[model samples]
Target: MRTTIRLLLKTYRFEFIAITLACLAMAGAELYLTSRLDALALPKECQFDQNISVEQGFATQPEEPVSDPTLVDSCQEKAIAFSDSDQRSAVLMSFGAALPVLAGILIGVAVVGRELETGTASLAWTLSRSRRRWYLTRALLVGAILGGVLLLPSFTANILEHARQPLIDPGSSFNDGGIRGPVLVMLGLLTYSIGVVTGAVVGRQLPAVIITLALALLAILAFENGVSRWESTLAEWQPAASSSYSIDIVLEQDYRDRASGLIVDQGSVFNAAPQVDGGPDGAWIDAHYDSVALVVPGSRYGDVVAVETGAIGAALLVLLGLGLFVVIHRRPD
Candidate 1:
């Protein structure tokens, strides 16, 4: 056990240094942003929550009382107008965020690939360390390093966004932008893990690196595009029709103002359609949205970024299982 520990510590020294620097870099940016947020006196309400950001809020007044902008030009204008300042930080962070994934490539080359390519492992195994202990140590170090590879950019991005600006309820983009962080981290981890597995399988340095990077990119794109299709086709379950209150939103005083606080209209929001009746067994899919309400006095609804934490976790587990199978099957047989 002690030998195993010493081997991992020595073998993973570079990985440890990389994760430390990345974390510090992220933490430094985050702390800077924390001070900035204080300086700006950002309100707690404006801070985004993952759950609340995914939903729509009561409309804020349009610069002009434009009817469903999405109606006129497909609301391409709304999406376009904000493109410049909208996600600049998030976009920039993504590129910077992908750097740590390179750690995987380096470690991949160093760990199993180097040993196997040089035929050094056979001699090393003749020593105190068994082949199993050696492989397990390598995998453990690579896994820990890969996990950190996934976190740095996101932590920095979060800090940058909060510190740079007080996330001032940037309309629909808030939730959309918030979702990007987690998705990007997943991208990084997926890429890193691919490198680790490929390195373990292929003993050559350059070939292993190339294969891992290519497969990682493909995996990221495939998953992203697939999930997007799923979101678009989601058939929102509706509720049964009933007599209930609804609000009449209007443009007033240069704001998309709520005419009244959930004004009691005779029509039931429940029966908005055949599916959602605004009540249980209804089509109002957003009922669990008790977290926040439509545009209230101080708060706004973020795009409901309903990420299934469990699902992402499950995907990681599945990939890990496959990796383990591959590793075990390939052992010196």
Candidate 2:
């Protein structure tokens, strides 16, 4: 076992180091971005300080509101215009947040697919180690490495997710769906497992990498949209507030006439159709919302994470079963 592991390490040392550095760099960049966002949301209250430049008269003075002038455009504007850099940060964050999924694909290809492609896997099986032990050791080592890579970024994302500026859209929350720390880790595992299974079935590195990545993307989309579709069946419907409530995981908010109880419009806080003839009027929608359905409450964010992780885990098990069949039936060569 030690020899196999050491051989694996010797074989993939460069790849492992590169991946570790990339993960650390990505985590650092994310933390830096989170700090920038935190700075923007800093309160505008005055502070006394010796470092203040009395002549410049700026340091001791309170910081100006980071929100743009257009915030007066409407209620929605207030929510949307918190910072000019917010939307940009959000876009960058989205890309940075996908690092784990990307990491999983690369690791899968390098660890399993490439080995099988180069006949190294067959060579390993011929050694003192049994084929089963060889495969399992490789898989477990890769899993442990990926899991360790996840720790810092996951913690950073979770911390910043909760401390996000109030004006940022709830849907954009870092804690949502696959974006959550634990969920991302599960997704990584699922993607890695898919890669291993695909490599075994295809017996080629390039094809396995392509198929595994494609399937990983499909799985992510499925989780993001597919699982949420069940909200209507599972959510608790309550009377919509005339005023905006704390925006959490609201599944549906329906606008209805108070007197006739006729449904006027319905959607999320950001995209709800207005009762009026025109597009959504932020003020009007706020006043007219008569009911809402809560899918997953803010307090139960952990529950949603568990459910999503379980769903991913279930899919992983299915892939594992298929892979087991392939490996058991086929020769390593």
Candidate 3:
């Protein structure tokens, strides 16, 4: 196994180098953009009540009075700054999402598919190693190389998410949760597995690559949909003070059936204010007018990660089993 891996590495050393360099470039860009945004101080509206003062003179005061005309002009550009940062984040997130597909196609076609097409895989099976061991070693070597290559992008994604902490919806792609870090590497592994299996089964590079990509896409959609359902839960109510919540908080403002927990209707519940305090009338208004926000709090992020990791891991295991089955049953030709 070690000899096989070393020979494979010796042959593909340049290709691995190229992949590493590409990932580094991607990580560098992600870090640079996210770090710049992180360095920017939060605008006044976003920083509300971050540091409140109880003293008579300091209460409700802005963090600092802007006296310079230039500084005042810059202050007015907060919206622009936020927009730019959001755009950068969106770009990075899109790349992160597309990575598995790319991996599936590239690795599936280039590594196993191409070898099978040229009969090199058959030749390898004729050597000292058993077919099962040879296939397993190849799979492991490719998986390890791809996983290492993908680490930079994964780390960059995590860094970008943490740098812009609490700046996006909990259910949104921008939130790290399971879409970044080890989860992404696992996703890539799953994709790679699918690709290699497809290639080995088909013994045609282009067709195997295409099939691998399609399978990877379907798997990703299924995984994402499942994770979404797992991550969100019903909340009976939320506080009226929006300032108390971060942007990562996801709230569903739908009218639900009290008995069935089904959302029967949708509209704003907090439409009016109470006229007075401490009465049946005031209590009615408080109960009715105070909207019930079905919130998914940031505290549940860990749960999201755990559920997604389990789902992805299960998928990887299933793919591995299928791949092994194909290799084990095949006759040497």
Best by TM-score: 3
The digit string of per-residue lDDT tens for model 2 on 1-333 reads 677668777787776777688767867766776776566543322112111221223343323433544432342432343354456555655765677777777777666567678887677667725656566677777777777877777766655554454343334332334564777678778888888788888888778789988988887788778767754444554554311223334565455555565655554433654545556676765565455434344445556666777888888778766766776678766
Q: What residue runs in model 2 are displaced by over 4 Å at the alpha carbon?
A: 1-5, 44-82, 166-177, 242-247, 255-289, 293-295
| Winner by lDDT | 3
Candidate 1 off by > 4 Å: 1-3, 33-88, 124-134, 148-153, 164-185, 233-312, 329-333
Give one digit per residue, the lDDT tens place, for model 1 in 1-333. 667657666766776677667656755655554554455443332222212221223332222343544444533443343333335544555545555556555565556666667777556656724555656666656666565555655655655654444443322233334333555455555555566567667867689988887877676567666655544443221111110011111111111113332322223433332452434433232332222222211111122234433445566556655555655566431
Clashing pairs counted in every model: 30, 2, 0
Better of 2 and 3 by TM-score: 3
TM-score of 3: 0.75
Determine which window of 10 residues in candidate 1 has minimal summed lDDT: 240-249
Evaluation by lDDT, superior candidate among 1 and 2: 2
C-alpha lDDT of all candidate models, in order: 0.48, 0.61, 0.63
Clashes by residue pair, model 2: 240-290, 240-291
Off by over 4 Å in 3: 42-73, 165-179, 233-237, 240-251, 254-289, 331-333
